[model samples]
Target: MANFFTTALFPVMNQYFGMPVTFLIHGVICLVYFFFVKTSVPETKGKSLEEIEKLLQKG
Candidate 1:
């Protein structure tokens, strides 16, 4: 959304900068995704389906 608006609102943005604002936003998003996966995204660290269901019900 921010990228789209940035490009659309500033007509010369793509011409002057190349690869539209979306490219920069995409790069940032990719960096964040890599960082998140490296630091936070869990590795399916859970138990069986039945156990998960039981815990969900208790919660």
Candidate 2:
């Protein structure tokens, strides 16, 4: 999926926005994705296996 998008969409973006802007757009997208996952995902860093299972069952 990523390869297809890069091969197909990248050229169109680069043509209109140039390589720098295209890269910046990708960077901003990555940052937004990072924050989205960070805030929306659950953390199980210190959880035991049973605790994790319970959390999953609740959800």
Candidate 3:
């Protein structure tokens, strides 16, 4: 998704704002997705599948 937006969407946005804006937009997107994944993605390090299932159910 990120790569698709960067390589595909960014170019379309660039037509309106130019290449530098496209670069900045893509950079910001990458930064946001990086933090979003880092914070929201669970570790799942040692938890069992049943444990995860219960956790999901609770939410």
Best by lDDT: 2
Which TM-score value belongs to model 1?
0.37
Model 3 has an lDDT value of 0.80
lDDT of 1 by residue, 1-59 (tens): 75586557455655666765646866787698789888764443568887767766764
Local accuracy of candidate 2 as per-residue lDDT tens digits, 1-59: 75577678888999999999999988887788899989877789999999989988887
User: Candidates' TM-scores?
Assistant: 0.37, 0.68, 0.61
Indicate which candidate wins on TM-score.
2
Q: What are the per-model numbers of colliding residue pairs?
A: 0, 0, 0
Clashes of 1: 0
In model 3, how large is the Cα lDDT of residue 2? 56
Listed per candidate, the RMSD to the true structure in angstroms reads 6.0, 2.4, 2.4
- Tens digits of per-residue lDDT, candidate 3, 1-42, equal 656656777668989999888888778877898899898876
Residue 58, model 3, lDDT: 72
